[model samples]
Target: MADLVSERASEAKEITRRTALERGAGVAAVGAASALAAALSSSSAAAAVPGAKAQDTSSHSRGTTLPTVVAGVRIPDSQLTRAVTEFARKVSSESLFNHVMRTYLYGSLMFDRRGIRYDREFAFVAAVLHDLGLVKAYQTPNERFEVDGADAARNFLRGRHMPAERVEVVWDAIALHTNVGIASRKRPEIGMVSAGSGLDLTGNGLQQIPADALTEILAAFPRAGFTQDALDTILSLCRTKPMSVLMHPFAEVGRRHLSDFQVPTVEDLLLAAPFEE
Candidate 1:
């Protein structure tokens, strides 16, 4: 059956991507109490999927002085693996969460390769820290919501010797991550700017959020911080992020194995049940 073949293809593609994450997660897990480890643990909810294997435990805490965080090598944990998992779940693991993260890394790497001059640091940090606002929102009042993401990123970036300016860029990007084309006002260590939040479950590419939900998110970022151009650019990438797996036009950007399954729409997204926690 056509459906059978499509599912097989989707699964095969997913396996290829997951293998990449297993190797990378192995690298991230090498650190003791590292961002990578914390991030991986946080995604315990997503790891509930059947047959998900543990990353090789050897790499992370292998008795190192300072963990190795290189240009291409990404140690996903908090802002990273977790964020990517959230995106995959929002789409019902349509692309297999691990595979989606792998694809995202590929996209980011491609962007960097194409003289984008970006670093995986921002992308990794932004991804891990992006949804931190959600955690903050649950703990704080709605007015404190938007500030939560930025505040968390600001706090985490501090001890790492992240330059004041670059930290500022990441903070701003996190604050308005839900919006689109935010420039990382903060100086980047690897010249890679922090793209905004990867929080959209629907992938509508919104960074500023709808005016109604703006109260919590906007509490940190004033209305003036909203930038239409930045928001649009982010949306464009998020939109094109799933052409291969999502059955969309730009899916040509990657190989979307959507023969058996189609990407969820806003309607399908709404029908999904609330997470019980």
Candidate 2:
């Protein structure tokens, strides 16, 4: 536990320092640091279960076997599923691919608990491709990583002949998964993707889930340093494309992790807006 805490603390500090140096925005750095601190605190609290010895699965145990069922439901193994799985595996590390799988499982479980009718396949697609921008193949400089990921998902589903509305839903879900408060109010598909990822990433909604259910999910899709891997992935993207993070959801995170990234604040944007005095 101490080691986990120490590792998270160091990761947070590095991200915060980089973002601060890159953007030269003290305020953004402070905000990013606070958010990371809160995430670490929430994660530590969630792990306070009885007899919890291991914080995450060891590297040796990863890829040994993945369960066929999660959260009391059998995972689908369609052609599309296989394609998406292969695409993500080719781009992401094993740990990140597992994280993506858990995102779907957790999202679907949340919908089931609410008695809501959700398109399980849609959730699966959205969650599976949610982090494409973090991979080198999908990285783009013109938009936020979320938008880039959304575009990639949109293109993939288009090739599969998915209906326009369904593809749009997946696109929106992936694009807005990082947005808090708003995603939950959108379509069920969108809401679940956002909420599920949050729960898996930071334990933000972990309290609402049954302990046994969470235990089952983790046992099936173990997190092998997912926290560090995710942070490192984000930092790497910011490093490669420092300006891309200027005004996106990860703006503050970027400002904290890169020494060369700088962007306009809301006030600056307002001053520069058209029709300004």
Cα error, candidate 1, residue 267 (Å): 25
User: What is the TM-score of each predicted model, taking all chains together?
Assistant: 0.34, 0.71
**Candidate 1 local lDDT, 1-277, one digit each (tens):** 3454455344434545533322121121111011110122122222222223322221122222212322353445554434433433432211122222332343354344455555555565554444343331112332222234456556556645577887776665544433322222333321121222232122222332344433433332222312332233223322333222232222222224334234443233333424464
lDDT of 1: 0.34
Task: Report the lDDT tens digits of candidate 2 across residue range 169-192.
Answer: 887787767764567789888877
Runs of candidate 1 with Cα error greater than 4 angstroms are 1-110, 136-138, 183-200, 203-277
- Against the true structure, candidate 1 reaches a TM-score of 0.34
Candidate of highest lDDT? 2
Model 2 deviation from native, Cα RMSD in Å: 12.6
Clashes of each: 36, 10
